[model samples]
Target: MRSRIIFFVALIAILVGGYGIYDSVLKNKDKSSVVVNEIAPQPKKDSVEYITVWRTLNNIDRGESIANDALKREQMLLTDALDEGLRSDVELDFSPSTLFNRDLPQGALILPEYITRENDPGYIDLLVTEGMTLYPLVVSNKNLISDFIRPGERIDILTVSSPSSNLSGAIEKPIRFKGVTATLFLQNIKVLNMGGEDSEQKLKPVAGKSEDGFTTIIIEIPPTEVARLALAQRTMHLEVYRSREYEEPVYADVRNVMSNYIGIEEMRGSKNKNGREGEL
Candidate 1:
């Protein structure tokens, strides 16, 4: 009877131990389910912001330059910049007083790429206009103010040459056309240099060649006008007259030289003992 009682007690202890194990397992399962249902924590958002930048004050037209007064400062969120490529006032190192390379509407951001600098070729190139070219004219004392002419001075150019070979088929006649007549060539052209001032070796007057030696002056002329200049210089003597009016261009193209400049023909073709053309 004692053995029977012990066996019954063992069975009851086993049942209690099994129930305790089952309850612990169920508790752990419930905790895992609760963790799975909870939402994931989001990454912290960036809070730092606010950037101040310069914007155009008015409508900046294409090819129009920007002045200091053309800009105004405004604040924007740093986090919301247009892109990583957008330039900020801090990143740019240029003067506000620069020409805009392209059109910028009013209230537009002043981009660094929109302005031109002195180092750029386009900056220096702007001094020359369309359909125009810079040509260097070699000059001498033929200009009354040759010694006094400077780079920025304006002057008039005249040509004295023999007219078209009226003596046709007169070749083998021992000589070509005799340059004598004078005409108005170019007017009011800007002179870039005088008396070889920009060169290391200064030009000295040619003693026995012509009355004055050769000195070169630079001039700007249109393409259409260039042919006239070349024709004059190729077969004629070129002389300069100072422009009286500084602000206006003057042109006088007269075909009749005998009426205007009397006795010039007789003065042009005289010769020295060396048979060289005499100085005017």
Candidate 2:
């Protein structure tokens, strides 16, 4: 009987020892898991005190390669006051100069919007960019663009669609349609070149006249809007107006253009109203 009691005690002791070992193993595993999680490096937010950024000296044109000497670094307090596109000197290596793929005005912040993968060493091509296009327009009118507006000028493009009218020759009672529609197609477009040349960046008209009587104009336009320009050129005519405004770049779509002319639509509406009054 004593041996049996001793056996029972030994069995209980073995179970207790096994439970203790299992509990210890479980605790050690949890501790190891916690340590592994804590191993991730946490950023000490307070350590970041200041940020260095670059600024522009003069007005920079699109696709113009930014020289290392033109930019001056300035330190600002590290805070959320910075914009998303703004660039910092700390992130990029300034040993190699970067190019601005877009226009950057004077006294503007140097931002990441100017940097793209294609903006690399050497001359920038206006033709190869994905969303950009080269639109060539021949302006023969000496009164319009050839003489006054030269290369490196921003101009507004006006378009008139279906300007021709039909006439049913009844001699005394000939039928005639008023006119086509006119709208502002483009505003503040970059003028690349005038008369096959950069026009020497001359503000005043050149000395002599051209024998061809036509000046070929090349402008930088987006690929998407080129189709509309093509359609307008085919169905109607385009006029160029010089712009002196130096505002930020603006973009528009074909939906913004509408027929608000007072010639046809307003006249028809007035006639319809008169007819309704006569019925009344």
Candidate 3:
């Protein structure tokens, strides 16, 4: 009877151990068969903010007038363009006289600081208007009041020459007078520049030659009058007289060589060139 009891207990212990191993196997199989659906993160989209700015299409030099075709428009991020001092299409001045103040490489952004207007100090060619020609009138430094005259001022040009008359028409015999006569050559002319004032030495006297030093007064004139002005400048002495804006040109002539005197004689004993007493 004891032996039967021992065998029955052994069988029960074996069945229990086998059942535990089977249960573990079933749990592992169930865990392995289950599927895990994972969701991945997506990338962020770009910002919708942007701005339109001007850019150069080719290399531009300093003091050069920028043409419309030489520039290009592009859309850029507002945050990036604002810090660069760039100009937009509408904000830029497209006048014919507008010029670049600094050299710009190809594909460079067009900035406001690089621009120069008519009032800026630089070369004056960019300041000339369309359909007008720039002519340089060379005058002696002693004759011109350069301190009073400035660019953009209006002035009348006077020519002083000895009067001449044709005695014989066929022979073209001319008789010239000793006294000099002055006449208005050009009136209400616009002064574009006073040359040789630039610190960079880019602007020099228009006529490279002068006897007692000279200053080139650049003026704007019509194409029709260029020939006359050029001829007069070469043949006679030119003088400048400041005039008002929109002032009608007046016919003026100066023939007197000396001022009428009402003065006293010198107190000291001084001999004049003509062997007479010197008078003041």
Candidate 4:
């Protein structure tokens, strides 16, 4: 009986020691797993690849030449910049001969599809940019228009009108005066087509004067100014002034026209009253 009890005790002690060793091993394994998880770096959810590309610094109009300072380099996400015709080069140079084919908003990515070359077919027709209107005007003053006028040149429009009384048959005011007035109608108007053909294709180069005895020019102007231009053309004679440099916008200034009117009045007054053909 003693031997059997000793045997049972020894068996119980062996089972307890084995169980303790297994528990310690399990605890150690759990600790190692937690340490590994804490040390491993986690990936960021917002991580992405980016590339540097060219973007417009300001809103660029169609058919406008790209200036060197007009473009800026910016970093954009790769997914956002992955267009087939996208201009991806950070060091790419814009050519002076190329022009924007469509209007681009500020910060727009430059692309090959957005540009047109000067030698392209129907280039003159493409000079009218978006939000602009083309107007055809008949001009008879050859002395004002130069022979070198061509598309892409800027010109100013003016009107000459004979003075009429503002009073509609009312009692004439004491200081009432009638004279001629020359007014500036429009400024910085762009020429698109001249003489029914591209200026480059003309053989004789007779601009502003042709066999028809009048010149028809197609010009580009703002949409809002179309009605004003039409009214000016219908009311009085229109003339063009080509300047070597652009001038600031100045609406009808009657002072300059009045000076000419005074000169004419002085000449008429200097003549003998009996020799005067009619009333002044």
Candidate 5:
């Protein structure tokens, strides 16, 4: 009975061991399959693209700081976004006043002041530096008073008594006369027929230039005459009258003057009553 029991126990042990080995093999196969399925492929990354943009500054007032106020904030933002991929240049335009504010057209830049050859062209570093005003006078086609008026030169402007009359009429029937001294831009006022040998009544403009094609004159008149001059400019043709005596005179020799004089020979012969056939 003991020998049969021992044999049966031995057989059961062998069967149990074989089943454990098979289960272990299955588990290992399952783990290998899961490891293959769980592996993730590397994700594709997109390449970053960069672009260039152009900009300009305009209407900056005179004496204003450009570095801090003009370019500080904008420059930081642009540089940050561009990350060394952007570049820029500055242009300055000067004028008398600020009236118009328009965005620069594509690929164009307008400056707040005139950048002369003397100004440094490197990157701007200061904020309290002086700048020129970007006014319409710089770009406009119209003439301005600064173009015509000069220093120390005298000018005449006819003042109008009535508000309706123009400058020409005011000069003809001058309600008043204003005498002004020309300053920097005196030549801007057209000096027409300045040294002509014609009478004042027949004085007409033979040649002239204006501040911007508009005739201007500087003469010694009274403050009250400004109105008439304004009226003449608006209504009739204004004439500029200049005295030859007051201006630099051109002297001619007596022989030259007598060359054109008629009957001068007769007068010379009469003076020589001796009739000695003198070389008159």
Candidate 6:
């Protein structure tokens, strides 16, 4: 009986010791996991504060290379402002070590051609580093009219009555002239006429319409030909002829027309010679 009792006590003690060891190992493992989590660094926020560099002049046509210079200037300005003890609620970031080598701002400013001259509050938006300086916006007179003229469009000419001309003659009838005929020429070749009518009788006449009493004829010309036409208009009295067929003004390819005149042998000697020339 004594032996049996001693054996039972030993068994119970071994089981209890085993259970304690297991519980201690589990607690240690949980503590180790928490320590690892605390040591790991957290990720930073992806967003940064942006500032505007205002008052830049319009029509600043510095090419793409200007981006680098603009960035350097922005950084220097920001650093100077910070040194002056200027404080704001915003958190400023203009670190050179960051992306872009601290050269430029995260945003850009697009300047206009002309600004209002009458002390009008004109401003441009620029992506600038913290503490950047802004200069007054400047503009050119040519840029003011850039939007008015464009590629493949009629010229926007602003004409005013001559002071020497009789005011009564100019204003009397308001010259209700409509459907005036005009001749259109491209490279001195008359391509089409303005009015739909074919005969001269149907074409109405306007008195004092032009200096010689002939109606002024306006023609749509390409940008390259604008200077040529301007000179021509000043020297020549433009006349309008009516046509039976109301044909749309068509532009011809001068190159193709010239090419047709070249003989087969001459075309073959040229750089773009194709074997199929004059084959048809």
Q: Please report the candidate that would top TM-score against the real structure.
A: 4
Error of 4 at 186 (Å): 0.8
Ten residues in sequence with the least summed lDDT for candidate 4: 165-174
Candidate 2, 109-198: lDDT as tens digits: 676556543335432463234567778875535325443665556788765443343211111321233444455678878775554332
Task: Assess the local accuracy of residue 159 in candidate 1 as a C-alpha lDDT between 0 and 100.
Answer: 61
lDDT of 3 by residue, 59-82 (tens): 998766668899998888777766
C-alpha lDDT of all candidate models, in order: 0.59, 0.57, 0.66, 0.66, 0.35, 0.33
Q: Taking the tens digit of each residue's C-alpha lDDT, what string does model 1 give over 206-237?
A: 22234445556667788888777766565556
In TM-score terms, candidate 1 sits at 0.37
**Can you tell me which runs of candidate 4 are displaced by over 4 Å?**
1-61, 65-99, 102-126, 141-143, 164-177, 198-212, 243-278
Q: After superposition, how far is residue 271 of candidate 1 from its true place, in Å?
A: 23
Weakest ten-residue segment in model 5 by summed lDDT: 132-141
User: Which of the predicted structures, 2 or 4, would earn the higher TM-score when compared with the native?
Assistant: 4
Instruction: Superpose all Cα atoms of candidate 5 onto the true structure and report the RMSD in Å to 1 decimal.
Output: 16.5
lDDT of 1: 0.59
TM-score list, all predictions: 0.37, 0.39, 0.42, 0.44, 0.26, 0.19
RMSD of 2: 22.4
Off by over 4 Å in 6: 1-4, 27-72, 76-80, 85-280
CA lDDT, candidate 6, residue 196: 20
Q: In model 1, which range of ten residues has the least summed lDDT?
A: 167-176
lDDT of 5 by residue, 142-216 (tens): 222233332223333222223333433222443322221121211122222122233341133322343334322
Q: What is the Å distance of residue 54 in model 6 from its true position?
A: 12
**Per-residue lDDT of 173 in model 6:** 27
Better of 4 and 6 by TM-score: 4
lDDT winner between 2 and 6, please give it: 2
Each model's backbone clash number? 2, 0, 0, 0, 42, 2
